[model samples]
Target: MINAFMQARTGSTRLPNKVLKNLQGLPMFIQQAKRVQRAKLVDNLVIVTSTDESDDIIEQLCNENNLLCFRGSLSNVLSRYFHAELNYPCDAIVRITADCPVIDPELMDYVINSHLKNNNDYTSNCLVATYPDGLDIEVISKNALHNAYKYAEKPSELEHVTPYITSHPDKYRLQNIQSEQDLSAYRWTVDEPKDFELISSIYENLYVKKPNFNYQDILELLSHKPELNLLNPQIARNEGMVKSLKKDKEEGYE
Candidate 1:
C-alpha cells in the first residue's frame, strides 16, 4: 500500500506546538492532511509521531480526524519510519512533514508516479529541490527504508529520517524530481514566528476564496503582493537539520 507517513511532534523548540496552530479554522496538521488525502495515488494517510507524552495530543488529534496514527522513538525518526512500514502495509512510504499546510495533492501524485515509473529505490523532490521548502516530498520503497534502517546510525541520520538514504546516493537508486523553474528561493515552511505569520497570511488571503488552491493560485497571489516573501526570507533552508548535524558532532553522537 502507498502510505503518506506524516512526521510530526509537539516539541519544536523554535515554534512550540506549531502543528496545532490554526490555519483557516483547522489545525495546520489537519489542513495539510486534508490536502494530502486528495492525492489519488496515495492509498492511505498515516501520522508517524513520537512516543513522548507531549505527542499524545497528536495521536488524539489523529483519532478525532480518523487518521491512522503510529507513535515511536522521539529522536530516532529513521527507525520510527522503518518500523511504521513494518507494522503497516506500506509499499511506497511517502514522507511528509506536518508543517506544510500548503501541500499540493496533484504535485504529490506527480512525485509518486515518478517513483513508480522510474522504479527507483528512493525518490524525492528535495534532492535537487526546485519546489519551496515546505513542499518537500520523499517516496521510499520498502526495501530502501529497510536498507536505511540497517546501515544508518549517525545522530543526524536518525533524527532527520532520510539523511542516511539521501547521504548514500550511490548505494540506492535515487531519483530527484525537479520543476522547470528554479523556485528554490521561496520559503513556505513554518519553523518560527515569522514563518507562522507568513503561512497564516497566505491562508487568510487564499483559503476562503479557493478551498483547494494549488501552486498557481499561490504564485498569482504572491505575484500581486510580493511582500509575503519578506515575512521569513531571513530564515535558511533546513535550519533544523543543520543544527542537528552540528550538535551531533559536539555531543559525540557520531
Candidate 2:
C-alpha cells in the first residue's frame, strides 16, 4: 500500500501563509487533503510539513482532522519524506503539494494505478501533463526515495523534495501522465496574487454548485472564461535537476 505524502507548509516566500488560507470556506490544506483522500489508489495520506514555528497550526489542524502529519527540516524536505517513510505503513509515496487545492482525483488515480501497473520506480503526469498548473501528482517507491536520499547531492534535492528521483531516469524508471486535453492555460495553483484571484474566481463561479468537480470541468469552465487563464500567465516552473541534466545531455552541452 502506498502512502500519499501530502507535503505542505505554512511558509511560502512568494505567498506567505497561504496553505491555511480558506478556499470556499475550507482551509487550503484540508481541501487538498480531501481531494487526495478521494483518490481510490491511495491507501493512506500523510501530510509532511516543516518544523517551522508557523506550521504548528498545521499540526493542530491535522490532529483535529485525524489525518497523519509529520514535521521535519523547514528547508530540507528530503528528511521530512525520509521520516515519513520510516513512520508510516507506506510501500510507495504520492507527492502532493499544499498549494494546489484543485488537485484532480482522477489524475491522482491514473498516476497511482500506472505506477503500480507498470512497476515504475517513480511516476507523474504534471511533469508532462501540461494540464494547466495544478494537476500534478508524483508516485514513487519508498526504495527509490531512499536511493535519492543516498545519491542526489544538490541542496535543492533536500529542500525541494523528489526532483532528484523524478529527473534521473537512468537511476529509476520514470513515467509521465498526460491528459488528452490541452489545459495548459488554466491557473489552478495558488502561488501569487493573480493565481489566488483566479482560484477564487473559479470557486465563485463553480463551488456554489459543484465542489467535487474534476480538472476537465474546471478546464471547460476556464475555457469559457478565457480571461481567467490570463490572470497568471507564468506559474511556477518545475526545474528538476535531472530533467535539466537530460536536456543538457541531449543538447551535448557536456
Provide C-alpha RMSD values for all models, in order: 1.3, 3.8
Give one clash count per candidate, in the order shown: 0, 1
What overall lDDT goes with each candidate model? 0.90, 0.81
lDDT of 2 by residue, 1-254 (tens): 87998888877777888988878887888988988898988889899988888999999999998899988887678888888888885779998888888898888898889999999999887666567767778888989988888876666567667778866878789888777767665657887878888888887888789878887778788779988778888655553445655654675655
Model 2: weakest 10-residue lDDT segment is 236-245
Candidate 1, which ten residues in sequence have the lowest lDDT sum?
245-254
Model 1, span 1-254: residue lDDT tens: 79999999999999999999988888899999999999999999989999999999999999999999999999899989988998887778999999998988999999999999989888989998799888999999999889888988778888888888887878889999998888888888899999999889888999898889998788889999999888987788998889889978887876
Clashing pairs in 1: none
After superposition, candidate 1 runs with Cα above 4 Å error: 251-254
Best by lDDT: 1
* Cα-based lDDT at residue 198, candidate 2: 85
Q: Which parts of model 2 are misplaced by more than 4 Å?
A: 239-254
